[model samples]
Target: MTIAKGDKIPAGKLRTLTADGPKDITTDEIFAGKTVVLFGLPGAFTPTCSAKHLPGFIEKFDALKAKGVDTIACVSVNDAFVMGAWGKSQDAGDKVLMLADGNADFAKSLGLDADFSAYGMGTRSKRFSLVAKDGVVTEVNVEAQGAFEVSTADHVLGQL
Candidate 1:
């Protein structure tokens, strides 16, 4: 089922590129004790993702933090290296944690996986954002197919 408010985030492993190298992060490790705002996108370096989705989060990082958000993360089906490079290019730095769902396991678990085979991009995560507190979802903003309205950082901040 698609994740929703009151749902516990599915258990799975996600990857993040650290200074040393790629590191594993359990879903619990990310949301267990924090109010996390996580936004998942179709891919790294894609038009909408690069120009708006990711940048919006980076721009609103401080505002989200001011509202008691512990972490703002950007998750995508791309591998860690790509995620890292994109984060760097976008100046995400420590403001937005770039999590890689390389194999789409976590995305599938959330029932948020999409088929983009027509575009030659196999399975990818649908664009969405959710707020999780202590591993339980308090809010979810899933965009309609091919839409970017609801999942933007400004909209999410309004929800908060």
Candidate 2:
């Protein structure tokens, strides 16, 4: 079942690019005891992702923080190296947490995976965002195909 409002994020292992190096972060560790704005994309550096989605979060990091958001994260099915590079390219500059779901484990657990094999992208994450507080989902927003409607930072900040 897809995780929803009031549902606790499931325990899953994933990698994050940290200052020290690649590090492991469990689902529990991500959403536990904090208000997190997490957005997922089909892939890093894809047109919409780089042009709009990720940039919105990068520009609004301070605003989100001012509104009491603890952590703002961007996640993709790509590996940590790709995610880290994308973050730097976008000038995310440590303003947001970038996570790699290289195995698609977390995406599958959330019932969200894009069938991009038609485009040779293989399995990927659907564009979406969620607000989780103390490990439970409080809000969820998913974009329509080829649309960047509800997953942007403005939409999520409104929910907060």
Question: Pick by TM-score: which candidate is best?
Answer: 1
Tell me the TM-score of model 2: 0.96
How does model 1 fare in lDDT? 0.95
TM-score of each: 0.98, 0.96
Residue range 36-85, candidate 1, lDDT tens digits:
99999999999999999999999998899999999999999999999999
Number of residue pairs clashing in candidate 2, backbone atoms closer than 3 angstroms, sequence gap of 3 or more or interchain: 0
**Model 1, which residues run further than 4 Å from truth?**
none
Candidate 1 lDDT trough over 10 residues, lowest sum: 137-146
lDDT of 2 by residue, 1-160 (tens): 6778988887898898877989998887888889999999999989999999999999999899998899998999999989999999999987888899998999989887878899899999999999998978999998888888899999998999
- Clashing pairs in model 2, backbone N/Cα/C closer than 3 A: none
Q: Judging by lDDT against the true structure, name the best candidate.
A: 1
Candidate 1 at residue 47, lDDT? 98
Clashing pairs in 1: none
Per-residue lDDT, model 2, residue 62, is 88
